[model samples]
Target: MSDAVPLLPFVRRDRAMRWAVGIGAGWLAAFVVLLVIAQIHPSTAIVDLPYLVPIVVAVGLSFAAAWKTSGRTRIAWVLFAVSNLLWLIGEVIWVFYTYVFQRGPPAVSVADFFYLSSYVLAVPAILVAIGSSGHLRHIRGLLDAGLLALGVGTIGWQVAIAPSLPHAPRLADAVAFAYPLFGVATVTLLAAVGLAGRHRLPAWAGLVGAGFAVAGVTDAVYAYTIAKQNIDSNWINIGWQVEAVLLGLGAVAAIRRPEPETRQRDRVRDLTAVPLVIAAMSAAGLILADRLDGGPITGGTLAILLALFAGVLARQLLIIRDRTRLATQLRAALREQERLAITDGLTGVYNRRFFQEMLRIEAERADRADSPLSVILLDLDEFKKVNDGYGHPAGDTVLAQIADRIRGSVRAADIVARYGGEEFGCLLPGVDEEVAIEIAEQIRQSIGRLEVAVGQGRSVKLTSSLGVATAGTRGGHSLDDPDGLVNEADSALYRAKATGRNRVVAAGMLVDPVYADPDLPIGLVWLADRIDAQISVHEHSTAVSRWSLLVAERLGLDMAALRRVGAAGRLHDIGKVMVADSVLRKALPLTAREWEDLRRHPDESARLLTELGGRPDLAAVAAAHHEWFDGTGYPRGLAGAQIPIEARVIAVTDAWAAMLADRPFAPTLTVDEARVEIERGRGTQFDPAVADAFLALVTAGMIGALAEPARA
Candidate 1:
């Protein structure tokens, strides 16, 4: 019972709708019978008095609908009520003359005045209800309505008005002319509402339009019959009865529909075919009439055809103009989207992605032209202090001012971009090292002189460290890599920060040989030191290097091979710099995701070796150090001899060092326990030959304890 209670109101509404429809249907049937009877019996006593009841009911429904609505809808309903009441008054007068005096009214009586006035009020009523669909849409709707109405008016002129013109009296003829004119206007208003936009009107709106259109057309036909002196076929009274019932139904529908908070607006439809269809039908009907009558071309018919041609041309022109405006707007929107994608939002400079892309392009240009290219990387010194001391807003002001100063100091051809955080990069094409250094020094000095306001009587001074690098010969060899140029500049920037807070350093001043005999390259050395200093991985790395050399020597490897193995062991885990320190130092066993991240170091180690040192051999050794002999390892699963000899050699030593060390995730094993573990995994985890050599070295006491020696 509780579940069904909420649905009771809806059920009642449905029942009421069914009753209203049934009553309307029965009333229309009775009116049709009356129309037939009055036609069959010429002197029937029935007149407009019986029709008065339906009009009165229509007036009540209209006022009730008005009371239930608000805004423009309410005004429209009130107008409908007034229009219906006016028609009712006219009908009453017609009944009085027909029954009391026992004779019909004159051709143009006070009844016609009330009837025409009701149609006039309906014009504004339809406009008020349907004109809410924006200005452009409404105007277009008017043009469409005018075009269609012209066709209907032309047909009416050819059929009715032209035939009976000479016989009718002047005042009666004027009244006859007024009916079709009012019919044209009323039909045009209804058409405008119907064809306005893609959105369908409410059921009430359709019924109202249909009611008015039927009445208007019927009145036009009545005028024709009167002009012909043929009043016997008053079967046309059926249209008035239908109009009454439809208007009443329209009013009831209006009361049932809930008014929305805002009126629904519609976009103009691209309905080109509607105009063509109307034009074709109008032209075809005129042609058929001309054929049937065997008549010459009339002036009235020719005028309507010309007017339709002009309307079609005007509609086509409007469509072209609208499409052109939309196309231009689309292009402008696309341009804005492209600009946003390539620009930094805060600093209003080219962003990091664009900077990297243009760097490669500039490098290619320099290579083809054989001209120098330079890059300068600048980092703001103590930028965090500005943010911490004066809040982020002041820091932003400082960054923007700093970027402006940098832009002002650089050449017009140079591209300035925000690399990330407090660092900005400048790419200079066709410029040598000397000019690049000069530009960097200028930028540093400009930044030092600038002071940005935080707020209210307080200002913060700024300073920046800049590093400049040019694509040219370094240590008697060509150093033309774009990434190498950026890396050199980045190294120089590090030196500038280390030496002093605000200074400029050039890559040429910090030269190291491209090839180091037994030592790592200068860039690789710096990278190794950074790894050790940042994560405290030096002890394990150093021990691994020493143990790898011993194992390699025991396996009959020469000095060059031993050195390569030792270097691979030291740098194999260098890629661990990217892993978080918390993961590296976790006291508990690492999660699978953390271990997966930890395993990426070998591949990164190889990439760094190849890019920075230009040594693919060392990279190969570093990349494959973790591969198992049985093909169950991360990154790449190169088993047995497929793994590099140096990597295989280092794998044994790396494991030995890890096992002996007091690592967060592993228990430190004593010498015998470590030996047992190594022997146990000789064929599976480690290469049997490499493991045998390592075990041999340990047994002979040539290698010391696996861990680093304790400090005194």
Candidate 2:
């Protein structure tokens, strides 16, 4: 009833309600006039016409309400129309008996059947209207409705039904008793709905409830009068006319535009509870009265009580179940939200935030236990090419696959995370430098083997560069700071990219620039300056110096010879500073004249080192780095042993670095391709002995060790 209030300006609502009241008053006045005329004339024609006219008008108004309302309200309106139509049919039959047959209708006749059926339709119509109004979802509301109905029905039965039941025939008595009981049930249910709703009850709903109440009281009076043989009364007809007019007014009120209802929870303090308690007390009193009369409780009475109890219990159980289900669903929703917060949306791996927290925790634990903790930072080589050439979708596919492989490759104790775009981080607790490097190498090789399908029939091979850094090593960077440890690993990663792709570089092998001696020989210091000028170069001179020492030692060179070889390797590309930046940064292949100008770098390096008072042996070796073993190379074309062994070693290491390192002029080559190139030039461009020593070091896995920073 509360849900049916029209949402309009206050002034408008007041005017509308006043208009409705006026119409209702006018209709009542007309009824009074017809009733007076009937009493004066006492003609069947006058009685039938006045009685039928108001009822027909009520039915028409109900149909109009049904047509105007929408959604669930329309259904309620239609049911109201049906009930009014049924009432009209009952009245027409009564008129027929009076005018055509010239006799009164029987008490339990077809007219009574139609009248009873109207109650049947009207009761559900009111209930549906309340239910569809969104006020009955609470368990308290249902309980309130049931309790009120039980109490009201009991009171009505005692007052109206018991007294007249013994005087009438069994069938007629049953029909008369059922009418008031049905009316009580309908009125109680409607009142409960009104009380349970948070908003004010609608005027139309109240009028409808009033109509039902009037009709129920009228039925009770008519029955009692009939049983007492005093039923031919104008007052009974007046009651019927009032009920019809009330129903008609209710139907007209239904067309008012409904207000937007403010929803609230029903409280226990509502006055509806008082009536329920009083009705219960009344029913108990009746039972006591029956006991005092020595009337044993019948099976029907017991059955009714048990049925009511079962209904209350069922409603309670359903409420409990619904609450439990809602709690479980809420818990699951929270867990899913937490998971989404920590996981990468594209790859489903731990994202940067989670990884950072985990790394900090692991670092603290490792520092406390004096255990090794390592981090491996990996970046996909040429990832931008995948995005540019194959499209972002293909790039995404490659990223997901790479993350999957990293997860599968690492041990369960290790944490793998997507650190950022094209970069991944792994935290390995209780892993040392050697083991971390081994794991990183495995990741590098595995990524190299990946052939991701971009689209069409085309596939692209992918590769990665990894850097390994361990904490808790003597004389190494501190592990107590997680950010410092990560920076160390990132530095090693930068070196890996600088020296070559598709390989792993260890933090222990990274050069400490702060510790570099300022008083170094002029040539080496000058070489460092030249290397710093290049944008694409990354610690290449340092890598070459380290590789040269490794190769010279492997070939059994003496300490003095090794020193010269290492110096020459470090200064090998120092003359590149003298070359034009345009030629150095060119993307296309160099022209023949540009190549000729490039060929003079070796001689220029020798001249600069010699003038700077560097070792003559180192300078001579740098000058002949391009001299071939077959005498088909460089400025002098010196072949075989004719080329200095130091120069030959530098040439092999320099070529390897150039092949592995990224350059604007050419794509980087894999380690296997570099090895093949080195092998192919063994006799023609490389000293056989130096080349053999280098390949032996590779076979023995010493090259990977040399790729790391020199341990203190």
Candidate 3:
């Protein structure tokens, strides 16, 4: 039902507006030439006919622009086009009366009807545009706009209107007075709307507003001169012609679409004192003019000055009140933001960062009081299955319900937090080992009772595994370090998962018994002992497995290939057990025979894994990892794609981990140096594609945390 039209067919619109602006500019120039010639030759038909050119072109361009404008703003453009058409009609009527009928312009003729109707339509058009922008919804904006309008209107009334009113005919006098009054109203509304909208008027709309203001000023001056019987002023006619050109250019601008609005800080608000000073100067000038004419100041002039002063005071008061209210609102908003930062957005509980801080504080307090402090880490069993079978939303529902149960099962003084994805941590102050285990059992049983609804009339029953660790209970290492407590709990949680789940396990508790193989090989047993002697062999294997899988994914390998890469990464150094311990931990550069001895480990690793059975693919990858991309490596000289892709991926990950890790022969490299080493070996010692993928992961910051050297 809106009058909005889409501003499309852009090429045509642009060309049409350009032609309109060019022609309008030319018409205005010709009008200037005609005025100069008229000063020497007096009245002529050439001047009369050319005077109508600018008006016709302005009206046509306005209608075209209105047809192209879109959105809610199209209503204002439509109204503006209608007003211009009305002005054109009025101009035609005036030309007919002056040149065709051979008579002077009439006082209240058909021309006056159309001319006055244009102003009537224009005022509401501007009001609708301002309303559509939604800037007037603010009370402060409305108040500022009203005060500004009042100030500017008062100045216009005193300077232009009152003096011409005393000596004219009844009809001419009425028309003369109406011109200045309408001029004041139109200019005030334009300025007020601009200020109310945060001084961010659209360029086309601002141009139109200025054009209307200029036209109003020219009309007032012409009306005043005509009432005093001086009607042949070329300057006044030239002013009217220029107003038409201004409006035409505004129409051209309107045909082009505007960009999306952004909130920009306006500097124009800082110049508010300019208007106040102008109003003060107008009042002072009026008083001085009256005294120079040998007359006392009238009561009307005094009342106007008093109203201006009162408006100024009210404006200042509004500004102060609005600023005070804004400050209060800002403080409340900042408090809410801080609360959100510490709380989980989805689960509505304390988050990981807040939980860590609270754990440190509680540990310090317990140390001072010489009291026992305990922590319980809980993890949901088979959480991935819940996400895969039902949906992620269902998984989220289960997590929230579990979080609620954990909160309810703990004491009032306990702190509960969602640690990270399906894991929750609870801090218990002043609790011994037995009480902490009792609380953990209660939480496990409570979570085991939850049945969450997961849409489509189906429900899921959930269970949780919990681990409890108390400070000063297991060698008292947790009292010195809060993170030590977390690790202890995490280990117990893993044991619970390894044994049957959905139960509680406390730190230092014995793991469930399983059968031992009597036929296990002594060589395998020796390998296990060496692995355990390396303090973080298990942690390094985990990091290498994760990094290899990521690189395999980037290379577009399938799931089976990914599994092979992970297996090779974990068992890459299994053959090192066959070498002597003295040779492995030498702490200096090796001799030729020592280097050959180390190089034989990869082939030994392949043979050992093959003899173990059902792991031939893992053995092959581990063996080929030492092969080079350029057919120059030991054990085998496979070149380019002749080597297995999984082995190539493992080769890059193994070198990356080794360079970043501390070893007996060399210190660990910095991250930047490690990256440079990998890049240097591309296409020579490492596959180029695999090296690029590893470097990409490093650049994305995905491997920085894993790049830390394993602690011994």
Q: Which stretches of candidate 2 lie over 4 Å from their true place?
A: 1-11, 14-18, 36-70, 78-99, 111-128, 132-147, 167-169, 191-287, 329-712
Can you write out model 2's per-residue Cα lDDT over 490-575, one digit (the tens) per residue? 98888777644556777766321212222236555555546634725444665566677768877888767766776667677777
- All-Cα superposition RMSD per candidate: 20.8, 9.4, 21.6
Local accuracy of candidate 3 as per-residue lDDT tens digits, 544-577: 6557876886788876786677666666677777
TM-score for predicted model 2 compared with the true structure: 0.59
Of the pair 1 and 3, which is ahead by TM-score? 3
**Which portions of model 1 show Cα errors greater than 4 Å?**
1-137, 159-197, 200-271, 280-298, 343-352, 372-712
lDDT of 2: 0.72
Question: By summed lDDT, which 10 consecutive residues of candidate 1 come out lowest?
Answer: 1-10
Best by TM-score: 2
534-649 per-residue lDDT for model 1 (tens digits):
54432566556656765775677876786687677667777777788888778888899999999898988898888877777789998999998888876799899998888888
Q: What would the TM-scores of all predictions be?
A: 0.50, 0.59, 0.57
Each candidate's clash count: 0, 11, 0
Error of 3 at 493 (Å): 2.4
- Cα error, candidate 2, residue 88 (Å): 4.2
